[model samples]
Target: MSVIGVVASATGGVEQLREGLVRPLLDREHQVAITVTPTAAAWIAPAERWELERITGLPVRSQPRRPGEARPHPPIDLFVAAPASANTVAKLALGIGDNQALSVLSEGLGSTPMVVFPKVNAAHARHPAWAGHLDTLREAGVVLVEWELLEPRTEAKRELPWDRVLAAVDGLADQFFQGRLRDRGAGVADGGDG
Candidate 1:
């Protein structure tokens, strides 16, 4: 089973954990692990964590592991950051991994297939640095699933669009695996690359 890492930031997307990610991963018989930002962990309800743990059977972590500590989660093949915050996007693109969630995301950049849903507000979306960061991420093969434009709303979830985020990541991961298999087959048939 493929292992997927779900990183949640302190935004409305955190609210979509179970339905948008956990259940879908479980339904696919994939193993799921979660890492949250410190503020994001505080945003989660205890009942939510209990339900997620029940499904994943993996402890959710928000802090970096101490030196020599056993790594609790498996190395992920696919990574998704939903409700990704502006802070998260900038740090990821700039190679700043000050938190557990960001570190996981940064480490997965090229090796692991990644999908990021930035929960940016209209004001932040207009910032000059915003487009550049997104550009850098897209250049690195990080797919971005953003909300369809509409009249601005104050409610956060309206901007988050977890459903779209989930679908985008699934489609991207499928494409990634298909390409990998095709490449491997071609290499074998051609008697390797020399």
Candidate 2:
């Protein structure tokens, strides 16, 4: 099973993260670890955080570990940033690791498979740098869930397009494992005994 590291930022639909992303991932038998932006940590209730911990069986991190502290979550095979705010996307594109969430995403940029769903609005997209930020991430091989796929936000709450995000994750993880398996097979074919 792949270890999926979910990073949530302070966005409108972040409250639904457990239901929309985490729980479904667990149901699919993937181990899940969560890290939230500082603002997001505050946005989620303490009781909710406890529930997340109980279900995932891992601590939900929002802050960096101290000098001697061992890492809390296991090494991640894939990363998902669902409900990623515009600010988070900008920081990630600029390689800014101001907080734990951004730090993880920043480090995983090109090496680890990542799927980011930027929960943004029209105004945010109109920003001149927005296109450039997306280009940078795409160049790094990050699978971006297009904004058009998300339902338009209204006075009444709307759910984020978690299905699309998860689909991207599933596809990327499959490709990653297949590539690894192919490499191993190639090694064996070349008479490298393991």
Of the candidates shown, which would achieve the greatest TM-score relative to the real structure? Answer: 2
**What lDDT score goes with residue 21 in model 1?**
75
Residue 28 of candidate 2: its Cα lDDT? 90
145-189 in candidate 1: lDDT tens per residue? 887443356643443566677687779878987898899999988
Candidate 1, number of clashes: 0
State the C-alpha lDDT per candidate: 0.85, 0.93
Off by over 4 Å in 1: 149-153, 156-160, 183-194
Give every collision pair in model 2.
none
Check candidate 1 and list the clashing pairs: none
Candidate 2 structure quality by residue, lDDT tens digits, 1-194: 88999999998988999999999999999999999999999999999999999999999999999999999999999999988999999999999999999999999999999999998887788889999999999999999997453334543567788898989989998999899889999989999862
Estimate candidate 1's alpha-carbon lDDT, on a 0 to 1 scale.
0.85
Model 1: lowest-lDDT 10 consecutive positions: 150-159
What is the alpha-carbon lDDT of model 2 when measured against the actual structure? 0.93
